[model samples]
Target: MPSGKGQGEPFKLEPFQKLFIRAVYEPQLKLRRVVRRAILSMARKNGKTALIAAIVLAHLVGPEAIVHGEIYSAANDRDQAAIVYKFARQMVDLDPELGQMIELVPSTKTMIARRTGSVYRAISAEAGTKHGYLPSLVIYDELAQAKNRDLYDVLDTSFGARDEPLFIVISTQSNDPEHIMSKLIDDGISGVDPAIVCHLYAADEECELGDEKQWHKANPALAKFRDYEDLATSIRKAIRMPAEEPKVRNLFLNQRVSPHASLISRAEWKACAGESKLQDGEEVYLSLDLSSTVDLTALMIGSVSDPCRIEPHFWKPRDKLIEHSSRDFGSGSHRYREWAEAGRLHDSPGKTINPEAVALFIAEMSQRYRIKGMAYDRWHMDYILREFDRIGLQAYEDCEKGGDGLRLVPWGQGYRDMGPAIDALELAVIERQLIHPNNPVLNWNMANAVATSDPAGNRKLDKDKARFRIDGAVALSMLLGLRARDRNIKPVDIEALIG
Candidate 1:
């Protein structure tokens, strides 16, 4: 019974809460429980904390209690972990029977049963000292916000020691599709594991944002615990501001929208992808965006003809490839390793990028294509420039004259330069005038791209605002800018024409 609201009263469980309790407690046979793992996904402000608190209390001292049983509720941070603990403590204080039977220690965030030696503790991911506990029930609150999978993996696998362990993951949908929580939800939905039960409350993909029916679909507590007036205000804000729509849909509609603000719509970008392949010995312009050893570096090549055909090359360090790939870099670096295995990406040795390998690849590419010009950001290009010189390629500034050979041109990445370039690329994608080989690396980068506008209304792709690497998009934009200025090819002033 919960007692904090007014007086020590019997805890009133909602229909959804009752259903969840039955799902957790109902036995398959005489003593065996049906569900070993339960995934509860819903929108925000849906009484998730209160329900989890009740379940924690039930495990600690109620009929589910076992002798010396250990129960844990974990979150990404200390404050989040304390949320459930605080609510449970309030419930204990409000009820006389619970207050007498439970001993609450606020300092350590632990509650112990007086008769039974069962204990409940709240822990955070940062406290990497959770190795010894053999938990009977583990409640993972807001699993979507977890930074990595270390704590989850440790706790999940440690349940093997218990006879009937229950792992309950209650979370909102993460904006990042590659997040561990998202992956777990996907696996749960596959229904391969009968012991795992998944309850997902989300709006349909075709449902329009701010639709009342869609809102009701995602939020079970719409008129019960959740206030309709507050949701209506949020809907108004989301509909009025285009930038806030994705976040609103993600948090309220339970949609898997991109974490970062997107520069291009996914549908438009997908529409532009085709089976068009770049021909050998074709006249092409190239652009390079170099990064330090630990980050991603990209080289994008494209023909200056109509329906520009683009190809990309990416490189990353080889050391700890698996570990780095598993980390959530919005889209996850696993895609990088996958591309490398497919021979589409270059995995350089050690922790830093190998400039020699990059130069070698460019030199080889120069042999295949009549490389007219190469645009590169001036930052961190000293080693690459020296490597180009070693390969008998000349480095030229935008203002400098060059011979009829492969020339490296210094390209500015500021709004004045990148604004027109991004605008041009967007126009090409929307008009279906650009032909790409449907490179997954480039597609991921494009999905991660976010645009920021200056006071003068000129916009450029902002890397800091983006959730993942946008090097491919940046390189392609630079190449497009250079191609637009070339006298040999008829330039399309896409912005001017559209305006």
Candidate 2:
């Protein structure tokens, strides 16, 4: 079997592997084996399959063997399930003494320890019919990749009749937090069940992307068995391409981050954070995005200058704020209440965000800063227009018709209008030409936001397709769009306005 040091050699357990074995198998206080289940998680290339193979050998023909013992390696699919069986077959083939003792049946991917009368086989959720078999030992490979908990439940329940049944799950962390493997990892760490043992090797979410020291936390076999330079190259690529970062962090760093589908990486969004307080007298572009009664509403005001300073305003109804915040919409992805208490998110008074309150806030801001222009989705602003009129915020067709009247730019949410603006925002972020108040709500919106691109490589944010609420990001993009289109914005005179 292959290992980090070299391939085609007898698989040997490392120090960490031995420690994990001890924790899983060692008996304590009247129990023959303390742990009924063991979960081992780490970054890829840590020789998990090899370790799984070794465990199978230990239980099947080694000291733990029992007559008529049934050992199975389970995976999401047949190909994956066959991995451990292949490795075990190689081990038995290489050893002359073991070759005399074990019978191999390649047709069904099964092995029989001749002396002990133990049976081992590879099974998958796809092969069909997983019921009626009592398993002595089950090693589940990459449980994170499983579509649902059906196979896991079957394997878990199958162990009931055995004397010392062991269920071992070995895999890298899944990108999704809601996966069964994720729950097992969490429960293992929480120490909820004394019978469940967990050995997780993963870097923290805040660990720097390029830190080799931090990389070792997730990759226990780094440099020893795994190639160090190969990992370094991957990290460099992740840093250069922000879109690949989520996968890199999830796969290599063993972090529970979203995969490649994320429109913006966490690192890219974080680099743009700052105290982006728009100067009191600066001419800033204003944009709005309205959400459903159950969702968020956003107002973004920002300077068009370099290092684009932005102050984002978010509102949710007071009644549903706590309830929405508590739900794991993305499975602990959002912390709306925490952000609200920190003075970042504003709470609307009633069950829904009132358009009058939004318009009045705009009118109040116009008192201090000159409303250079306002951009909004044309389809949803009809009701808000009456609120604008009631609050004395007059709308002008263009800057030419605007004499102290707000130039209302009707922005469409289609690719034709939004594609170029999205490009500008992406470029600004990459170039470090944008700054924000380090608002968590805004950051969360951007993190949750995903984009749909055209054949021409023009990409626009799709709120419908996003994993979570993206109101702030949509508003910010519209603000950037207005900032790009209009440049004749006049700065405000604060003292004169007050006088």
Candidate 3:
């Protein structure tokens, strides 16, 4: 049924598909095209496999063929890997000309063109340690589902000897924005590299779930590829089952939402973003989130002024920056590299954040800015306090600076304390009162943040099910919480939010 083998309707390229092909294959002043990679991403049931089959056929024996060229269609598993192969095989069988030239070997999930001696094989991530294959073109299907990037790295590197190698990735999005596919999609969408061609067809995240008008954004083949009545049935079922909403959004709308939701929406956080930053001699309140040695450690500095201007000092081990971004788990594929290049992220020496460096940095900030002392979690305050002593900067335990020394106030991480902090940040965002340098790291943390609440409706930042590091946002909120508390500005009514 997936192959549509007996369907009388001929396989033809849609306008969208044709445009993608032209962008990928069309040459410029030179004979070879500029693009080395093409990413075609959309929702399911979009005739992706059929379009892929056509491209495979063209390269195997038709217009794009070359002698002994090796082509591979890869997926996360064998079953998915064989899809394009099966489609191409059935198409070959339908035409006498193709049947005469192409040899189908179902057992191996391979097709060979007799005329050109070119070979196409279906491979998957399970087939690890693939080596010594000179690939002219590698088609990765649903690459976002891969458990790791090993298979992709191998196949990509194998194209080293080819003159004009092309790597084609066709898939939906990954819920984790750090996945390799997600990174590629972001880069492609950003147009960071002109050598990469990307075509994405997906509905907006805020689009009405069952709205038929918005369906075409994600499904270019809505009517021609599948019966509209059947799609409507699926939509109706999903609407009735609230639990099925995530599935519908992920699979049908092609959104990046996972099982857990973000604490603050991107639009909400972006709304409060400003170019405002810390000023010399400006009164500053600080929050220090000292994470583990290998994790991110953040410091948020903000003024108590009406339009609360803020800045951050975020540090990670210089050595682990790239490794952190490329990991399969925990905030993989973040734009750490880009942020680092832009001087937005600070790199500490070696493989761990130096507490002495952090303490020294704090002392330095005190010289330029008047202090309201720094709020800190007790989790790793000893390390920082010890560093302060080593640098001859006395870290006082009071809220305001005492005897020209640094003030370190305790900020608990539990709901009892963080509940107000969370409320304060939310209120500031709603009122457009907080301003920051629009730091990418802070923005990312805010987007990944999620909140958990107690029976009394007291809430705290939930890192357990959160997308990734939320230290910066937590710290930002703590400073805002302190501002409201110290200034006796009436706190956000927790009962109102709870009620």
What Cα-based lDDT does every candidate model obtain?
0.81, 0.80, 0.81
Q: Write the per-residue lDDT of candidate 3 for residues 23-42, one digit (tens) a residue.
A: 99885547777899999888
Poorly placed runs, candidate 2 (over 4 Å): 1-4, 7-10, 261-448, 451-460, 463-499
For residue 280, model 3's alpha carbon misses the true position, in angstroms, by 1.8
Q: Best by TM-score, which number? A: 3
Over 219-320, each residue of candidate 2 has an lDDT whose tens digit, in order, gives 998887877998899999999998788888988999877764656566677788887887777877899898876579999998867778999999888777
- Pairs that collide, model 2: 4-225
What ranking emerges by lDDT with the best candidate at the front?
1, 3, 2
Worst 10 residues of 1 by lDDT: 327-336
Sort by TM-score, best first: what order? Answer: 3, 1, 2
Tell me the tens digit of each residue's lDDT in model 1 across 1-499. 3433324556677787777777767848666887899988989988888888888988888878888999999988999888889989988888889999999999999999999989999999878745787999999998888767667877888887788899999999887655778778989999898788778888876467767999988888888777778887898998898778888888888876686657776667778788666789899999999877678899989986878888888998887456567763422236557778888778999877889899888988888898888989888989987988887765565566645556777887888778878877887787787887777778778878898889987888898888878888889888877777674434456557657
Where in model 1 is the C-alpha error above 4 Å?
1-36, 61-67, 93-103, 113-116, 147-150, 190-197, 203-209, 238-247, 257-260, 266-285, 301-311, 318-345, 367-373, 392-410, 428-444, 479-499
Tell me how far the alpha carbon of residue 346 in candidate 2 is from the true structure, in angstroms, after superposition.
24
Q: Per-prediction TM-score, please? A: 0.78, 0.60, 0.87
Error of 2 at 453 (Å): 10
